[model samples]
Target: MPTLIRPFGALLLLLLLCPLAFAQPLPGVIASLAERAPWSDPLEALGTLSADESVTLSATVTKTVAEINFADGEQVERGRLLIRLEDGEEQALLRAAEALSAERANVLGRVSQLQDRNLAARADVEDRQAQLDQARAQAQAQQARLANYRIRAPFSGRVGFREVSVGTLVTPGTALVTLDKLDVMKLDFSVPEVFLGRLSPGLALSATSVAFPDEVFSGEIATLGTRIDPVTRNIEVRALIDNPGLRLRPGLLMEVIVQQRLRDTVVVPEAALEPSGDRHYVMVVHEEGDDHRLEQRSVMIGERRHGEVEVLEGLDEGELVVVHGLQLARDGLAVRLLGVMDDHTGVREILEAHR
Candidate 1:
């Protein structure tokens, strides 16, 4: 009886020790502290670029081009002479008018002196004055005609390729070249009429171009259309972007994003969310004495951006949430905290470094 009792006690002791020896260790997970960050709803649209100021230069009269003062793609100043046409006839007429005007002035002065000495009649003095006035009028007319032979830049800007060269005959309204002010660019885009209430001058926006995939351009709204299109139900918006480097050109297509409705809210990593049907859940690390346990909590999420989610409810600032090894996380389960992730570091980097 003593041998049987000893064997049974030993078997019972082995059974209890086996369960403890085979117990699994706590699961490891990476967590991040929930923090408040600035959040905004973004509105996206496509935009077309244009120069702040643009025009095509043309000739005002029919004449042969005598001199081309600007080269293709040349920077010119306002009122700079760009083209000179053959003006020999106009110049000759102006010279003749000037000579006649001088002769008339001499006659008028002589007649006035004679009238003061009682040697000439008053009618003679009046006739001389009228002749001088007529001659001066003719000279002024000739000068006005001569100005049509020259073409000058209307504004300071870059000139496009020349369409005509020296000795080429050009008629009135013939296009000579294109001039554009490229120091600033104008971006035009349309937004739905529903956003008209939110649209205003001085609103901030960002733009990107396929031609420059790595570059982002910043700008602000300059104007909003007064009326919305009845057919399209959209309104036009214009933005101004500085182009100090002259990298942007007219007619380039760009993608634009407008920042709207900004607020500061509690946020967490998107990876920490576990979707259960229509509800989202997160494993929050709760401290109990010296041990850390996970508490499964449902969260109300709002806007999502850049791998981060805005937590509208069921979360608080400075609370730790699991971001990695989520499969091992469970309510009331003990977890080994591997590390904490920051705004810049990734979970894979933290895990590799921990190992």
Candidate 2:
């Protein structure tokens, strides 16, 4: 063969043997990735907002309201006067009883002097003493009834709707008002009764309310209902959160996330896996027949976080798992070698800068 022909043949052989080694590379596109991390048990649910401290206010006496010291939905201090009633008649009775008791005391003293001189019968002295005791008892009773006319707040809280107005005749058993202390709010949620044993007071949780979508509130496992709701088959639980501004109101809907347990399962980006009915699967690149090929792998998913999923099996650490472009990849499909895509750098930078 001629020298030029021989050189051309040698180059052709090199091309056939190393197709990937010598071709002008296609544009280096960013390859997607699925990074594995330690999986943790995630708990999530929806709930309703409630005040950690809530109570009702009611009238304690039967009388016509003389004065209303508070307006509806106002904050009140503990022991602050809230309502006043007619007390002039009761006050007069108390005063008259006191004068009569004073007169009875003087009579008892005279009777004691007569008895000491043996001029009065013992029975007579006893009768006068009994009369003085009855007068004093009547005076004490009148004072108690009069004191009840003035109603005061039992605690510092935000009052609810007013059932009656000034000059409204109210009785002892009337529904007066409601008080809600919202400084520290509570969230009432429910979980399947099967998890009842796992719940306890003081468990930490994170919650959100529609009123403040941007903020996350901290709370704790405050209480759990003793009996499950038979119709719902769910166990009611409550969490307490500090709300200094009283922005959280009772009966408002909320979302709650609780840390149920700790786990060490494999975690991957949610994009890496595809759901197939009950089972989940992902694509992984592996060496097959002297060439790199994509293989379909079935993985058992446990929990989810953002765009991530927990892989209970079928994945290992340090192994590359396609993230974004996996839907386009097929089993045994040849993929041109590109660099692994890393989206975590931005997250790390943000956290580092914050620190």
Best by lDDT: 1
lDDT of 2 by residue, 1-355 (tens): 5979999999999989999896663221123445555554546789988776677766777788888888888999888888788778888899999999999999999999999999999998999999999999999998888878877787788888878787888887887778888888878889988777667788778888778999988988888988888999998898888886778888988888876764566666676777779888887766466455677889887878887787778888656666645656776676543445466543334334434
Which candidate number maximizes TM-score?
1
**Tens-place lDDT digits, model 1, residues 1-355:** 9989999999889989798777888889999999998887889999999999999989889999999898888889999999999999999999999999999999999999999999999999999999999999999999999989988898999999999989999998999999999999999999999998887899889999999999999999999999899999999999999886788999999999988777899999999999999999999999888789999999999988889999999999999999998987889999888889996887888888877
The TM-score, computed over Cα atoms with residue i paired to residue i, of candidate 1 is 0.83
What's the true lDDT of residue 58 in model 1?
91
Each model's lDDT = 0.93, 0.77
Provide the RMSD of all predictions against the true structure, rounded to 1 decimal: 3.8, 6.6
